[model samples]
Target: MDLAVAHILSRVDVQGADVLLIDGPSGAGKSTLADAIVENWPAAEKPTLIRMDDIYPGWGGLAAAGEHVRTRVLEPRSLNQNARWQRHDWTLDAPAEWHDVPSALPLLVEGCGVLTRASAALATVTVWLDADDAVRKERALARDDGAFDAHWDDWDQQFARFVRDEDPVSSAKLVLRAS
Candidate 1:
């Protein structure tokens, strides 16, 4: 996996195309690859990791506000009106960000729906990782520490819906398997 990444990096000599998206299903090692790639890149070209989760408001954040708009609301409304929509809140009731999207570029968006039509249209390259369902479930379980069984189940369902609705894998530039 590491060597594969190195090969891709070496061959992709696009100057100033700093953004390289890493996308995949849950537990497909998007984070693992992102970390390794950034770590492996030269200091001048080292990529800064921008997790979609960080840009998003967590359950705790939205639970309290109830009706508040997310910080990222304006960015999408003005940037693109058709982004894939996802908004949720917790007991705190704060409103999480949502978008339904249009193409935007020069930045790598790594996560479940990062490679969808909106992103892929603008991306220079997208890395899609794959693993068997059993492996994916096992990795997901280990990563969540058994604390989000119900949430995980719900997430799985959501991922299915997202994939069915927007098949990002077909558009990826590269398909990789973590194991």
Candidate 2:
């Protein structure tokens, strides 16, 4: 996985011509990989990043959030227009703010469901990450500090359905075992 990201970084123009999507089930190290990429990226060519976690409506809004990202972010970005989308505040259980996604190239979209077939077609590269289920569960719980305990199973189920339907890994340019 490290080498894959490194290779992708080497090929990036860094002057705004790439759009990478990193998708995987929860605890599959998507965020970690995203962070690594950004950290290693040249400071002069930093890309805009959007985490699906921020876009999701709630614990049960995975499918809807995926659609939201497609319609509100990726589509408009493809047309070279600002993407207008709402951020759902989990605590308030409502739309909290409107984000005007800048016309930035080399965008990095990272999270589960971020690399659907439709979105993948628009990306310069797509990476799919995976890990053992037990490892994923342990990592997720530890990261969230038990706050995600009740929602873990629900999110996992959604992830399974998403993988079954989207087959994101099959479409990816890189498939990584993040374990």
Error of 2 at 55 (Å): 0.9
Candidate 1 deviant stretches above 4 angstroms: 56-106
**Predicted candidate 1 versus true structure: per-residue lDDT over 66-154, tens digit per residue:** 11211232234334543343444433434455543332322345666555655555556777887888888888779877754566666
Residue 62 of candidate 1: its Cα lDDT?
18
Top candidate when judged by lDDT against the true structure: 2
The C-alpha RMSD of each candidate to the native structure, in angstroms, is: 6.9, 1.4
TM-scores, in order shown? 0.69, 0.94
lDDT of each: 0.57, 0.85
**What does the lDDT read for residue 26 in candidate 1?**
74
Q: Please write out the lDDT profile of model 2 over residues 77-174, one tens digit for every residue.
A: 89988887788997888988988777665788899898899989888888888899899889989998788899998899988899899999887998
